[model samples]
Target: MGTAMTNPAVAALIARSHRLGADPRTTNYAGGNTSAKGAGTDPVTGEPVELLWVKGSGGDLGTLTENGLAVLRLDRLRALPGVYPGVEREDEMVAAFDYCLHGRGGAAPSIDTAMHGLVDVPHVDHLHPDAGIAIATAADGPALTEEIFGDRVLWVDWRRPGFQLGLDIAAVQRANPQAIGVILGGHGITAWGATSDECEANSQEIIGIAARYIADKGKEAPFGPRIIKNLDKTVRRTKAADLFPIIRGLASTDRPQVGHFTDDDVVLDFVGSERLKELAALGTSCPDHFLRTKVKPLVLDTAPDAPLDEVTTRLKELHEAYRADYRAYYDRHATPDSPAIRGADPAIVLVPGIGMFSFGANKQTARVAGEFYVNAINVMRGAEAISRYAPIDEAEKFRIEYWSLEEAKLQRMPKPKPLSTRVAFVTGGGSGIGRAIALRLAAEGACVVVADRDAATAETVAREIGGTDAAISVTADVTDAAAVEAAVNEAVLAFGGVDLIVNNAGLSISKPLLETTEQDWDLQHDVMAKGSFLVAKAAARILIAQGMGGDIVYISSKNSLFAGPDNVAYGAAKADQAHQVRLLAAELGAFGVRVNGINPDGVVRGSGIFAGGWGAQRAAVYGVPEERLGEFYAQRTLLKREVLPEHVANAVFVLTAGDLSHTTGLHIPVDAGVAAAFLR
Candidate 1:
């Protein structure tokens, strides 16, 4: 990227694509494709040949790089129409593209390849801008296109993307030499140019014209006033948190899913509108929208102010009906060759006066699906303003949804990590073993909630894991019951619900039997024992409500078993925590929540407890130098090697990541063989 790119034509193409993609009005993420055709020397023949570089399948235009481009011989690609067996068998052309490749062909070509190669222009940009789609999906789209652009921009009826659609667009372009672009009915927009600059400009111009036309000609109050005005922000968020776990449970009936929640005013407006039910039932207008969001959302039927009991009951009934409807839809269109129905659960759910919730295999996919639906909402608003909103036929949607090529893409996804679709909530995650545990869980593909008293450090660790979609930070003093409950609510609000709860917050104070004060005893027990109980108790509600089964882990210490001098309070507190593992495991088994504990001795390198004066106190007690205490502790162990945070993190992974799914109420020692503290 930084001086790595060599080809000027490809460079211009990428730059233009980024410009178009950077604006949300231009395209949604991973929705559009761009291409550049230029001269390249044939390797064996050493003759100048025409080469086409197009955005590869499943790649986003804004983030696209040269490696994301599929290069093919223009002559061979343009020749495909001759051999094309028409629309029914146009899918076979995707396989034939490999033969047209120049060298290895940077990335796999998408079905839209023909749309780029067959065009006579040097550059082509196909986008799904909201305003353009509004015009494309309007009932009077063809007539509106004729009236607004006056023939410079033409119209094409709804056609599923394939080699046939590509040929069709090319035919329209050739028929009207004066036309700059064409509005794809019920899809998006495609603009071509003599050069890369012209192509990008034309794409922007088309989008601008459509936007201006909609704004000037659009009718007011198209959604027919707000049916339920937004609830107060604080109240709305609380309601969202309450509903999220329930919705997540219903959504995951088919497969375990991660969820995302949004309460932006734009989303609030749409959900609260009088037309919400009618428009949502018609489904999203754009192909990309429904592809991620499913054909339509499961909209809550009651007013947002409905009592919680009433709303939850209604939601469950709606979910059941929705799944039944979805299965019937699948049965209606599926043939022998159709890709198997992935899931009957709705990906998007709408609650009036509250917010929208979306679900997917991971956080980013769920979040993006929400964003695409927001785009669809905007499209619907504009279309209804100018004319009635009209999407493609449902049969056509089923064709694209169950297409074998789409299935191949699904099959091509790399195997998920062991912890994929799991969300972990780690207290004391800003530092020490908790930080290490959070990092490990994220690396293994779990969304993380890094909760700590230190706001800055918690956010830093969360940022390290990756931003909003992967991990989020919540600041809370674990000892406070209210704070613990609120933090769990934050996790529910952020990632729908928690799958793993790690009670790792603690502080150590060393004192002999007679010198230990009541304050020290209460502080240690309150933090390590009661704090763990509060966190587990609060998160267990969401886990139980989700009905998805989860894990609760305690980072207890080897001192819980070993009698250590000058550590009466800390040791007793950890011992209390250790027993809680078995107790909770027994009580929670019926709910499918596994409880486990990891006991590690003297994890000195990155120990928050050791760093906070415990090292020097223990050193003084053992008659060793403060700096040498770690070595002293290691020498006394059977393995004679110091245990570390990473070692404890590995133990956490093993206990929860499927291998030990059947093992619970277990305390696995990670003390490098401390015989005295070994589990019996």
Candidate 2:
């Protein structure tokens, strides 16, 4: 990467790719591939040779780095056609591409490598822009190309992407010397230039012209007349919130799946349109869209204004039907060597008045799948207005979806983390022990909900964990039952449902029996005791409904056992939390929901409790400086070590994940060794 970036042509290609990818008009996320050919020094022969640098398989042009591009000798690539076994054996060519390496080659060459390499151009851009696809999927796309850009933008008939399609494109380029680009039938666009700038300009011109053509000449209602009016924004979102968990559960029948819901104006319009079922059944045209969105979306026939109970019943029936149809679709096209049926669950589900719900192994995949469908919608709109919206047939789609090359790519991906499919909800995650727990769980590959009463700090912690895919922040007062219920709902909507719950939200009121007012006891009890119970009760509904086993961990204190001075109210509340763990464990054991607790001595550093004046109060009682309390506490422990929040976080992880699956109703002490606080 370091040496390659120094080459001027390689640099120009990367810069151009970034610009094109950044705009949705040019390409969807990771939708297209771009390439440039340049001179490279042969290490052994000390001779200058032409090299091809193309965006490799599974890379996004917008965020491409030098390493993301594959390097190959142009001479070897151009020579492959001499021994071509034809389109039937084109998949083998992807393997042959390795032999044309300029050096160690870089990332693996994409399926589109031949298009860039065999086409006699210095720079090339192959894209799947919505506007370009709009025309490509049109029945008269070739005529439209002639009508709009004349011969300057040539047209290539539909051909599945392979060495043959590459050769087809190469032929088009060679024949039309004045043509800047070719509109690929039932796919997207490919443009080449004498230089990087010219190629980019050519691409933008084609997309802009197609977009304007559709805007001016296209019909107003491309999807046909609207059949159902949309519900109000609040009702729409509420419906989505209600259905998300149930849909997630149904979607996870084969394997656990995270989901994303989108009800934007575009999606709403499409779902409520008369052609919703027809267009969705036709599926997506572009390889990028089809690969992400599956063969076709599952379209719900229920009206938008149906009752929730009726909708749920009908949805279940529709879901089973979709799965059966998908299974049959696979059987119709599968061969002895075809990749094993991955799953029958539809990736994208379209519901009128509600929205689209897309599922995948993770949130990012689900979100991207949803976005690809939106692009497909735009393509459908334009194609319908100008000509018939024709996508590749089912047989062609099956060939691409189960392509052996794609299966190999999946096999090469690294194994997922232990908690990759799980989601964690951490209370009081804005600061202290909860924050540490949230960060730790996320690191282990769990999507996290950082819930705190303070919205700002919760947001800050969520940002630290990563983007919306990995974490989201929710503000709720746990003592209020409704707030606790709403907070759990947020987790369900953001992720699929809660797989783990860490009841760590609490503050302390330290005072001796004489000075402790009734208010002190009630406040501590309300937060630590009642809050934990409310959170557990609310989350249990989701976990049980998911029908997947889950975990609930309570963060108790050593004071729950030890009779520490000036800590009666705090100790009693901690004791209450500790017992709830056992109680829930016994009650929920039959459901496969493990309940556990971690009892830790005061973790002063990063402690939200300590920062809220508890540190000064405790220090005064113990005759030490507030900052020195940690050192004093460390000296008093049997291990002579101060307890840290991370220690408790580790204990929580151990109890919930991996080897400890069967163990439940257990309490692990994270106090470094405080004999007085130890369980008898």
Candidate 3:
């Protein structure tokens, strides 16, 4: 038979890791690691030698590939236990691992590499499966595991991941030679076998054992009625949609944190239970969750129906108290031997009847935390059903949360994009200039809301962008006050709050002064003037409540500054809207909301107004073919370059990204240097 070092063996191992990691029930995002022992030719010397290909730190196993695995000399890694006579320092041990790399590329191997190496097997799978965690965190976890798996499994106490953890696992393996797996109390599970298939099978078998055990215990009855009563009361008195903005604003930092509000029936039921405080105070279900969610979630005192200003004040006070409590936890846990750890505040916030909110540096991180918490709720519920939920004690949580090894993993993470955690609202986002802006903002890592008058078109744009976690579609008529209000509320519900608002919904009209009807004038002003006001007013309320200073940009036109012949109604409305931008900026400057405008001339292509027959009529009046109309405007500018929709979007990005943070109430011409439209 071919040895485990064969190419097929390695390929099978990689495939198994991807499959296990892809399921959140098996592994949370980037939370698990896998390894396989094999022999391969050294890239430098071309000599056949034993090696360990392990999942690298910070690589998501769900989408892991060959490059995501780091290759290290097996003999060198196994020798690590002998090289250090006593407990090894984290930094020195990491340096030694770095020295043993067989190749120069790929990320550093997972911090748990030594643990995987100590196992006496060809294949190893380490996972934080929800079912396994549910069983492992129970008060009688070890007893339950023994009852379910007999001699097949061993239990290891919680130890910070490093040299010590490997030593503990090795000790367990020494006593139980027949053991196929080991459960790390308050941590996760590890399974090993001689082949990739065996390793995967062992994991599934162990998980099934625990899952059935929990299922047979039956459900906890008290949790349901209490939760339903609280949730119903909260919903009756207060709307989650109304308080989301306030919570988002108070939770934000200078880096612009985002909130993901989820009231999924399961989550609401969990948060509404009478034992929420007790369950939350029990600590995280697993050690891996500590890094992403902190020690425990912050439970807010405000309810859904509370007054807006009153709730905002309460949140600020609660957040300050939460920070103080974290500092206290750090001080009590720090010792002469403790690693230098930064104070990490709560990443999840519980809002009673409203459900829970997860905060992160970016949308993906927030969503990842949200997923972990949801799993945690299930695990806690299961543990409560069978017995008391007993997670690692506070000191153990501190050791893992502040472990130098875990801190090193964070240092290796990539830097985020400029607009990483900000949220943007784009009106008329289904197409044209609005569509371009939405795409650009999303690319910069901001969660975007595509708001348009057409519901289907907005949904198409949102699908093209992605889902609710990344983007959502809201149908809104900017000219209608109630619709505009609903749009802002929807955005808040979808992404917690709004950081940027792009007012780009407008129509155009061209006619001689004598031929211009009152109806035509009203139509132009209603969309250009009234629409901009309604959208801005709705967004400003949330921004001011948040106290985080936001951005608003109106897509104006050159007709505002330089009126052309036979365009009375269009020019008048555009000019009025531009002046309104200045007044709004002056008033909102106190609240840190900057209002700006961009004026683009003759953007014929990809424009809804131009495509709706206006371009052809305008071209005929100018005695130019419709195809050449873009060039006609291009030649009129000093730079003589066509002003594409992208150009206007770029300017919008500049204003919203704080490039011109100090300058507001200004209109920058994106018309390739239209001299007549120059502000100066």
Candidate 2 wrong stretches, greater than 4 Å: none
Question: Candidate 3 lDDT, tens digit per residue, 305-414?
Answer: 66767877787788888888888888999988776646444688887777888877876777778878888887788777777788888887887777777676677678
The 0-to-1 C-alpha lDDT of every candidate, in the order given, reads 0.91, 0.91, 0.81
Name model 1 segments beyond 4 Å from true. Answer: 1-4
The model with the greater lDDT, 1 or 2, is: 1
User: Model 2: which ten-residue window has the lowest total lDDT?
Assistant: 237-246
Q: Which candidate has the highest lDDT of all?
A: 1
TM-score of each: 0.98, 0.96, 0.93
| Clashing residue pairs for model 3 | 238-305
Q: Residues 154-215, candidate 2: write the lDDT tens digits.
A: 99998889899999999989999999999999899999999999999999999999999999
Scored against the true structure, residue 671 in model 2 reaches a CA lDDT of 89
Weakest ten-residue segment in model 3 by summed lDDT: 228-237
Residue pairs with backbone overlap in model 1: none
